[model samples]
Target chain A: MHRKLIESFGIRVRQCREKRGWSQERLAEYSGLDRSYVGEIERGRVIASIVTVQKLAQALNIDLADLLTNCGPPSGPGRSN
Target chain B: MHRKLIESFGIRVRQCREKRGWSQERLAEYSGLDRSYVGEIERGRVIASIVTVQKLAQALNIDLADLLTNCGPPSGPGRSN
Candidate 1:
């Protein structure tokens, strides 16, 4: 809900973007979303659906678990893939 | 989409339930979800929404980032919290 949280989400996406050397445009193309919408997501202007997040994770060749984990600490026990 | 993935999500929820020392009934009371629904989630009988995940994280006193991280690996470079 906080701007910072959205930014944090954006930062996570950005990390993936950088990892794949994809611009927002490229990520949109690869992920089958609108380029501007991706920008909004990266800018913390939107709350993405779980499906979209899953698509982003897959397009980035990343796991949703890792993406979520990268942003914060676990509240309880860890899981194994 | 895979059964394993659904089960993984269930496991994540169960970990949080255990962390809070709450049974399905108590967790449902605290999280505003049905008890049987909670059981299904834990048993990998369902895929929860992000809103549900958010509630689970809050009830467990954990960050969403931590919960997600506990589940899997980052396909690309990881981000710092």
Candidate 2:
């Protein structure tokens, strides 16, 4: 996995959660994920499944696109989109 | 996992591939995935990780958001986001 991309994604997720005044625990509760797992995600320690990403988007009351809009570098050749 | 959502995502992936006139094998080649795995994803038989999704999007020359924009039902309450 691309470490930088994962870190960017984690930062975006954390920012979104904070914007809603939700803790990792609160976000986990709403997303049906474990609190520690959510923390891991925020720290870019885990590669989340698409379903997990969708769950987080829903819990944040945002579109999945919105959640990912600012994540990572711009699309480029020879890299994962 | 949510069956409907997975199915919808599969359909979207299939549509995108077809739009580019690429077969599953071609997509797999471009995305650095196994052909059978690509087929499984198109059939909604497995839940893809975010890294996998990014790879496919990159191979398809599209954004991850575009791939997921029309997937599944609208966001609803009490469901994994």
Query: Which model scores highest in DockQ?
Result: 2
Give the alpha carbon lDDT tens digit for every residue of B1-81 in model 1: 646666876887787666555677877877678899889988988766556676666555566655554632221232211
Model 2 chain A poorest 10 in a row by lDDT:
A72-81
Per-residue lDDT of model 2, residues B1-81, tens digit only: 467767777888888787666788888988899999999999999998778877877777777777776533322332111
- Please list all clashing residue pairs in model 1, or write none if there are none: A62-B75, A69-B69, A73-B66, A74-B66
Candidate 2, superposed: residue stretches over 4 Å from native: A71-81, B70-81
Q: Ten residues in a row with the worst lDDT in model 2 chain B?
A: B72-81
lDDT of 1 at B44: 83
Runs of candidate 1 with Cα error greater than 4 angstroms are A1-3, A69-81, B2-7, B18-21, B28-52, B63-66, B69-81
Give the CA lDDT, 0 to 100, for residue B42 in model 1.
88
**For each model in turn, which proportion of the native inter-chain contacts is also found?**
0.27, 0.64
